[model samples]
Target: MKTYVCPACGLVYDEAAGLPEHGIPAGTPWADVPESWRCPECNIGKTDFVPMEL
Candidate 1:
């Protein structure tokens, strides 16, 4: 699975280790994440996230 990084705060969202704290279960894919879900670290929208290089 791929990972994403928040541009504002460098928060890393790993697809294999979903954000359970935000109700996103483990192994959840990026496309499955709600559009309204913001970065927990910086509160930035999903558009602010970029694909991180593995």
Candidate 2:
């Protein structure tokens, strides 16, 4: 699995550790995330996120 980072607020979204707080289950892939989902910290769209390097 991969991880993504919100460029606006530096929030990290890990595919292997899905954001269950926001209703995304564990193991959810980045592409499976909803288009309407926004960064919890910055309130920006998914487009504002970039692939994060491990």
Candidate 3:
């Protein structure tokens, strides 16, 4: 699983535990982000997050 980081706020979106209630659910494909989710902390769109390697 990849880790996503919020470019605006530096929040780390973890695939392991999921994105909390504001995140995409487990097994959610990237294509589904637009309709399925939003950032928990800032309510920003999922597209704002970049995949974080570390």
Candidate 4:
């Protein structure tokens, strides 16, 4: 599994459990993350996520 890091707050997105059940609005794009996934802490778009070594 790949772990995603939030560039805004340095929060790591867990691939084991996946995105939260309900934090980011429903239908939020997670597939093409770096282009659409939003930061749960800051609500910033995917552009804020920086892939880190997991």
For all predicted structures, in order, the TM-scores are 0.94, 0.94, 0.62, 0.58
True-structure lDDT of candidate 1: 0.94
Stretches of candidate 3 above 4 Å error? 21-36
- Please give, for residues 8-29, the per-residue lDDT of candidate 2 as tens digits: 8899999999999999999999
Residues 1-54, candidate 3: write the lDDT tens digits. 667888877877666656447546775545555654666667777777888877
Regions more than 4 Å wrong, model 1: none
Measured with C-alpha atoms, the lDDT of residue 10 in candidate 1 is 93
Better of 2 and 4 by TM-score: 2
- Say which prediction, candidate 2 or candidate 3, comes out ahead on lDDT: 2
Q: Candidate 4's residue-wise lDDT over 1-54, tens digit each? A: 556688778877655556656454333444534455567678877766666784
TM-score of 2: 0.94
Tell me the RMSD of model 2 versus the true structure: 0.6
RMSD in order of candidates:
0.6, 0.6, 2.6, 4.4
Model 2 scores a C-alpha lDDT of 0.93
Q: Provide the lDDT at 1 for model 2.
A: 97
Please identify which of the two predictions, 3 or 4, would achieve the higher TM-score against the true structure. 3
